[model samples]
Target chain A: MTEEGKQAVAKARAILENYKGKKLRIMEVCGTHTHAIFKAGLRQLMPENVELISGPGCPVCVTPADFIDEAVWLATEKNAVITTFGDLVRVPGSEMSLAGARSEGADIVPVYTPIDAVEYAKTHPDREVVFLSVGFETTTPSACLAVQRAEKAGLKNFSILTANKTMDEAYRALKDSVDAYIYPGHVCAIVGTRLTEELTGEGISGVVAGFTPSELVTAAATLVELCSKSDEPFFRNCYPRVVTRDGSTAAKKLVEKYMEPADAVWRGLGIIPKSGMVLRDEYAAFDARKKFSVPSFKAKNPPGCRCGEILQGKCKPTDCPLFGKTCTPEHPVGACMVSQEGTCAAYYQYGGVV
Target chain B: MCVGLPAKVVSIKDGMALVDASGAKREVSAELLDELDPGDYVMVHAGIAIAKITDDDASEAASVMGEL
Candidate 1:
């Protein structure tokens, strides 16, 4: 927390006290908020009328099965090198995981950045390197820069499989699920405050939040203020330090130059329109999908996973029968158990749920 | 949420900064930010120095937070 004090807590207590009989169904649509809320025990602190639900914010959790299957296919069938974030490597598809494929001699490397993949491609000229780019607006700029770097270096073997998503579409689809929203702060830092402003302007109570525990508490108190005081939806910024109304112009321009918005398939939410980024035709040679067609196969989630319901804010992780018992983090049965940012994994690790 | 860490800038070369993130040094792009120095603290995310955090900025934000 940036500053530790008793005033914010007292103010939040006052707000919750005022809303004793009224219910505020607020959904936190950011993975960090989910973790922070649980870590701070804010759910336990809030009154019962203050219902805080987790949304489909974790990119690792909401990555559709087919995307993983395609990454696995590229490695197993085409013998191409796979590069991705650590969390994605363990996510289970319908058939196999990238780790499973790696155990079978597939070269899938976990990297801290997309630049590492570019470096790998530069060194291994003979091998086809496909960077599995999975993230939101905050990471999409780096992915674009990597593609630009690879092109500048004249790396013919490098391509990217992008699964980047935008948060606006999800908010649009989930408007009715909650009375207000605690938006993702880091995400808003990149895409700008316009996202939350847009949603709020449309009659959805919302606030952008920072990752700190005290910030979450303060944001909850602010949300109660906005919802109870105004019939009209309003926007509040709890993370004024990092996020601005316009966001990073340079990053946004690069994204516009390299990628275009397309429909994306979220794990629980299914296909949401214009929520994903795809490589532009100008960057056609750097697109792994255009270069090598992944073998098409029917995708399915694990039986009794209930990850879909969890992603949609319809149910909690404990609501699922396999949450802690059959789907522990060590051996995850669903995508939620595979990542620390995931709702189920966070609840299990924190040893409590809302 | 995006994974980020505050790192100290080591050196600049070709519009990239070699930064030390908790003892482990890694090269990240400095294209997204404005000014930088060898010892300045930067918020790095996905191999890019996204923001430069200063004492005034921190305290200003903290004061606002305390007000909440």
Candidate 2:
């Protein structure tokens, strides 16, 4: 380790220790931050008075079961080819996951990017290709580009199931209990910290940070400093190299070109107002939900899973009776266990950093 | 999952850059990020280069990460 790096960690720890007697709740709204916190052992290393909780950060974890059921409907009943990111394959729905459904002859392909799915749609015009678009600001541009590409190619067969969410909407949903937030850097990479800044307006300290171990630890300490030391809340940009105060203008423009804000349901958080993005009326030709008769059904979490409470930070993953027992990563019973970024998976994989 | 990775730019052509992320090369859109070069590092998400990191920031974060 470099001398500076050692000094940085030491300094952060020293600052963190100063607030030993005060109680604080620091929530990270990004799944990557949750994994990074566990990977760096920051949550355990913090003062016991400082409690760290994972929010509805994992897009896959937060995507409601009914959405999955709708996706299953399109893939199986409609004989459509479903292309999704690697994370969604194992997220179990009411009856089965996309992976399990694939085993039953449903055509589901996992692609690294939506462009791959767009390309697949181009080649196979006989079958309907539905890309399960699930992500935050970071992945929204790619989905937009996919629609733009599909439009340019005049491909009527290409469509998308968009479950894209905005962090600000989700933040407002849980702002009352949160003292501080470690903002997702990738989301800020495109949308910046403006929404996070608004959290500060409401007396919540928010810090945008990178994925590195020291960066997360440092950001956590900064949040502690902001909330414990100051009466005023503010947004701190700890990751200046990649994150700017105003993020990529082009990405936001593309989103406006292709998508419009809409109400969407989260797995645990329920339907947040204007939390999701839907294909704009102009790009309505590429709307998967409209093209298919995907039924609107009320989704429920697995009977014993407390993923809702876990997402809202009301309870920890271990609080769930099935967390490690019946809901191992290999056989997850809840949405929280489906993705590596999910808090349950993070806890299970990283030996309980919380 | 929002798993963005730091990747080095390998080549640029037609508004897209081929990046080497952890020894694996993949094509990423260079639309949002600016001033790209072969050695420059970027955070790649969903086949797009969302942000670019200067060498100084890269080495600083690396040194701090090295001890852990």
The best candidate by lDDT is 2
Q: In candidate 2, what are the lDDT values of residues A160-201, reduced to their tens digit?
A: 998998878788778776777788888998988776777776
TM-scores for all candidates: the values are 0.92, 0.93
Q: Which ten residues in a row have the lowest lDDT in candidate 1 chain A?
A: A1-10
Write down the C-alpha DockQ for each prediction. Answer: 0.43, 0.41
Per-residue lDDT of model 1, residues A1-354, tens digit only: 223345555566577666754677889887877887887778777877778888888888888888889999999889999989888988888787899999999999998899889999999999999999988888888899899899999999999998999888889899888888888877877778876787766777788877666666677777887677768888887777677787777888889999999998888678999999999998889999888966665687778889888877788888999999999887888877777888889888987444
- The number of the candidate with the highest TM-score is 2
The candidate that wins on DockQ is 1
Scored against the true structure, residue A117 in model 1 reaches a CA lDDT of: 91
Task: Name model 1 segments beyond 4 Å from true.
Answer: A1-21, B21-24, B36-40, B54-68
